[model samples]
Target: MTEVLLEAQSLKKHFPVTAGFILARTVSSIKAVDGVSFIIRQGETLSLVGESGCGKTTTAKMILLLEDPTMGSILFRGKDLQRLTPAEMKEYRASVQAVFQDPWSSLNPRLRVGSIIGEPLVVNRALPSKAIQEQVRELLLQVGLRPDHDDLYPHEFSGGQRQRIAIARALSLKPALIVLDEPVSALDVSIRAQIMNLLKDLQHQYGLGYLLIAHNLATVRYMSHRVAVMYLGKIVETAQTKQLFSHPQHPYTRALISAALRSRPDTQDEEIVLPGEVPSPLDPPPGCSFHPRCSNALPLCSKTTPVPREQERGHWVACHLAETLTVATRATISAEERP
Candidate 1:
């Protein structure tokens, strides 16, 4: 059995809205991540897929210890992160790292590529300056950058090259887990595949666990071992990548899959356009958060929030009508495709 590297239980991050003059009191809160739970196994990549404003980034931030959780806990290697003190938290930072979305914004324009990659090592005081330089050179080579390019600044490299430097910097800490927050979203289409392949190789070489957060299902499909689909601020479905793609249970999952399939001509032509806007987190509707936009929503969907239940082996879904609704949807699609 694969060992669990990171486990987040009922993690919630709610930013309070205070409205007053000098003495401010909390009025309401914006629930960015609400009760999200998942496990990342050692040497496995778990991709979190969701639309924009779905709290995926916030969840990643919490896992990386960048933001404190308002409720619940994050356990790394069976140790509760919230229970740790400032000194321990600083130590924990060495074991966990992050790769942000924009490469241009992530790297310092004034710093050379070598210093940027070696900065973490220097800050952590993990190695001597000579050893750090050698490590930086090796990391650059590992990420497909030439050793001679290390002296150049951020502007000297292309967008993809800058991202490679960002990745190299993340790996410098020798982290056990890395939260990849849309690492390739800013790269060109042609360079994206190369970067993805590099990431896969690095994971294999280092046995690194990843929490890959992205909105692109296709990219997630290629990179992830397990996939979690999120809507609003909650996870609606989670399963092995192959199983999720083959048998999506939640309505939101089905819609996302339908959209992904539509983008590929060889898959299918039908597109499932989810109607209605996503409700505001500040004023979310009662009951199921996705019920307002779900096509097959029933009366119970608006009355009670469905807890995530395992309908199949290693497959969990949070929907009142997952079983019946999924079957009906498959049948409808099959009938439409028949000659």
Candidate 2:
């Protein structure tokens, strides 16, 4: 079995909602990530996909130790994160790094590329200044940037180049896992492919695990070994990448897959347009959060939440009627595609 690099067990993050400006009291709480769980293995990629405000970024933050979970535990290499000592914390920080959506915002404007990439090394590891410079040069080469470009500032590089610089910084520490939060969404369509290829190459070269938070199913399909679908701060489905794309059991997953593949000429599955807007996370609807937008919703869906159950080997779905609904959906699509 592959070694699990990181795991979250029923993780939850709830921000307190205050009522007044001065002497405010807790009125309610915004459940950003509620009871989410998954694992990332050594050298494998597990992606989290969902619509905006569905707690993807929040989950990433919690995993990175930027935010503390309100309930449950986060285990990094079998050690609970909240219990880490100061020295262990430093080691943990070096083990996990992140690349954000906007490369320009993440990089320092005033610093040269070499300095930017060397910051992690300077902080985390003790080395001579000369050694850091040599390491920076090698990192630039690894990320496909010219070693000579190290002298250039952030403004001197294009968006994709800046992203490469950011990637170089993340790699400086030789982290075991990297949290990629919308890494390619900000780049152009042409540049996106290059960045994706660079990431794939880096993963292969370094044997790094990735926890990718993305809205683009296409990108997820290309990069992920496993995929987790989040809806209203809860995971609705999870499976191997091919299995989830080919046989999504949740209604929201089906809708999103339909939306993503609708433009492709080879698509045979009929489009699933969901009704109603996503319920506010501040005050989500009762029972299953996706019930409001689900077409095949049952009375049970509105009154009782469903837990994730494995309908097939390693394929989990949270819908109450996953088996029947998925079977019906496949039958309808098959009939529609018949000559």
Candidate 3:
């Protein structure tokens, strides 16, 4: 079995909504990330997929320790992060890194590529200036950029190259885990594949674990070892990539897959158009938060919270009717149309 690099157990983060500007009182709380849990194993890519504002990024933030969780715990190799000393926390910081959605904003415009990539080393004061430069050059080369291009500023490079530079910086720390927050979404479709391939190659070479937050199903399908689908600040489904793609048990998961398949002109699968807007996190609907948008929602779904069940081997679903839905869905689909 693969070693677990990082684990988030029932992690929760709630942002207070203040009514008044000065001497404000707490009106309500936005449940940004409510009880999300998962683990990333060595060299594995675990993807968190959901619609915008579904708390995927919030979950990543908690994992990176950028925002303190309102409740629950984060463990790095079975060691609780909250218990770490200052020095140990600093070390932990070095062990985990992140690459954000926009490379243009993430990379420093004024700095040369080499300066940007080597900044981590410079800040940590881990290596001499000459060694840092050498390391930057090697990292650039590893990410498929020419080592000599390090002198160029962010503006001089194309979007794809800028993203590669960002990636190189994240790699500079030799991190065990990387939280990639929509890393390839801002790039051109053509460049997205290249970046995805590079990430996979890097993971294989370094035995790095990745917590990928992405909306692109094709990219998720190609990159992820395991996948967790989120709905209204909660994880609704989780399974191995093959299992989830082949047989999604939750209504939301099936809908997402249907939509993804519809995007391909080649596939003729009927699109599952979910009705109703996502409920506000500040005032989420009772019971299953996704009940308002769920097609197979039962009366009980609205009154009782569903527990995640292992409906199949390693495939978990949080829904009142997952088993019934799975059986009905399978009975309707011909083997030829299944993706």
The C-alpha lDDT values of all candidates are 0.90, 0.93, 0.91
Worst 10 residues of 3 by lDDT: 261-270
Pick the winner on lDDT between candidates 2 and 3.
2
Q: In model 1, which regions exceed 4 Å deviation?
A: 85-87, 261-266, 327-339
The predicted structure with the larger TM-score, 1 or 3, is 3
lDDT of 3 by residue, 190-270 (tens): 899899999999999999999999998988999999999999899999999999998888999988898775465687877
Query: Quick one: best lDDT, which candidate?
Result: 2
Write candidate 2's Cα lDDT for 91-204 as tens digits. 999999999999979998989998999999999889999999999999999999899988999999899999999999999999999999999999999999999999999999
- 1-339: candidate 1 lDDT, tens digit per residue: 878999999999999999998999999999889999999998999999988888999999888767889999999888898788888788789988998889989899999888999999999976889999999999999999998888899999898988999999999988989899998888999999999999999999989999999988889999999999988889999999999998889988888888775464576655789897788899887889998888788899899999999989889999999888868877998998999
Root-mean-square deviation (CA) per prediction: 2.0, 1.6, 2.2
Q: Give the C-alpha miss distance for residue 15 in model 3, angstroms.
A: 0.5
| lDDT leaderboard ranking | 2, 3, 1
Worst 10 residues of 1 by lDDT: 261-270
TM-score of model 3 (CA atoms): 0.96
